[model samples]
Target: MHPFVSVVIPAKNEQGNIGLLIKEISEVLHALGNIQFEVVLVNDGSKDNTVIEAKEFAAQSQCQLQVISHEASCGQSTALHTGIFHAKGEWIVTSDADGQNDPADIPALLQAAQQVQTEHFCIAGFRNKRLDTPWVRLQSKIANGIRQRFLNDGVPDSGCGLKVFPKRTFQALPYFDHMHRFLPALIKRINGKIVVCPVNHRNRAVGQSNYTAWSRAWVGVVDMFGVMWLRKRTKLPRIISEEIE
Candidate 1:
């Protein structure tokens, strides 16, 4: 069966969380009733048993689950790219492997995407109340302020893992190391609409964060400048009409 939506999750060492995350996703998608959904879990060279746990859950899962593995650890952006590229669904939903992004919010994002008139669009989740350390939150705030001022993509939380967009829109964007963080800006560069939806955020139940605030900020600053350059050079043509004889 062809899925209407595919949830792509990137995990490195999330053995404890992978099974639970997939179960939650299955429950949520099953409740939607009319929607046909699948889960694509990309195991990014996990040292732990992340793949094993995911496969165990997939055996009993009502939803279709596909597990892809990377021989070596690539970054989250590349794992996301791999999952989305292989996904069968037209609509792709991204979630973190840490189980912080709530599965219940997926329906709302899909609904928002459906409401958009244009085919090229993105629905980014806005985490109004983050459940993280004060220091981490502060760092994120500073980074977001800098990003917003420069990109002006009008997305409040581009870092939020819960996002809904079409696979075609994502494929059209240029692939980069940290392109995942600048999705809103990239979508805008391609003349796509951005919609921000308020979603639930939770503290991590298990496993440490793969990246620190400092690490993210450092790479983010560089990637932000790169996106700015791409934005400046981007020129979208306006086609008036097409005639087929």
Candidate 2:
């Protein structure tokens, strides 16, 4: 049977977390035996044993599991796009590899999707109180504020990696570097709805973060303006009356 949901996780040098994360995801999804699901772990050119660990767990996973590798380190957006492109499931869910994103919250996102009764919309997680350093949280807050004001996507925590969306909807979007950070806005550009649900945020217990608040904030500044431009030029027609001749 084909998977109903494809969980795509982007990992870069997350050897310590990949195995545990996969185990947690398997356990959580296995409990929900009614639904068919697959976990796709994208190894974003990690210079560690991440690929090995993932492959080991994939071999023993009860549900379908796939591990995709990149020859060089691409950004998170590219890794996610690679996994999404290869995903066979109708629904796509993404999460971080640092083990901060709880696998238990996946069902809630699924429930939200069912409750809304739409596959074209996105169900994103809102980390009410992030388990990061105070400075990190402050950076996120400022970045989110600026993004919300400019894109008006109405997403409070756009940086949360946990998001549930339809695979087709994601594939339809114009792909670019750092696009992962602006998914809600890009989805909105196509007139897709955004639903934010409060999700658990855990402290990173293992590897150090690949990103820094200063670097992300700086890059985000540039990406935000580009998104604003895309939003301005977007023309999603309210009415379409196309007929084949």
Give per-model CA RMSD: 1.6, 1.8
Expressed as tens digits, the lDDT of each residue in 142-219 for candidate 2 is 889888888889899988999999998998788999999999889878878899999999988787999777888898
Q: What's the C-alpha lDDT at position 173 in model 2?
A: 89
Model 1 segments more than 4 A misplaced? 1-3, 243-245
What are the models' TM-scores?
A: 0.97, 0.95
**Candidate 2 overall lDDT versus native:** 0.88
Tens digits of per-residue lDDT, candidate 1, 1-245, equal: 22399999999999888898899999988887888888999989899999888888877776698889999989999999999998989999999999999999988888888888887889999999999889988888888999999999998887899999999999999999989999989998888999999999987888898877788899999999999999998888999999999
What do the candidate models score in CA lDDT, each in turn? Answer: 0.91, 0.88
- The number of clashing residue pairs in model 2 is 0
Model 1: ten consecutive residues of lowest lDDT: 1-10
Indicate which candidate wins on TM-score: 1
Highest lDDT model number: 1
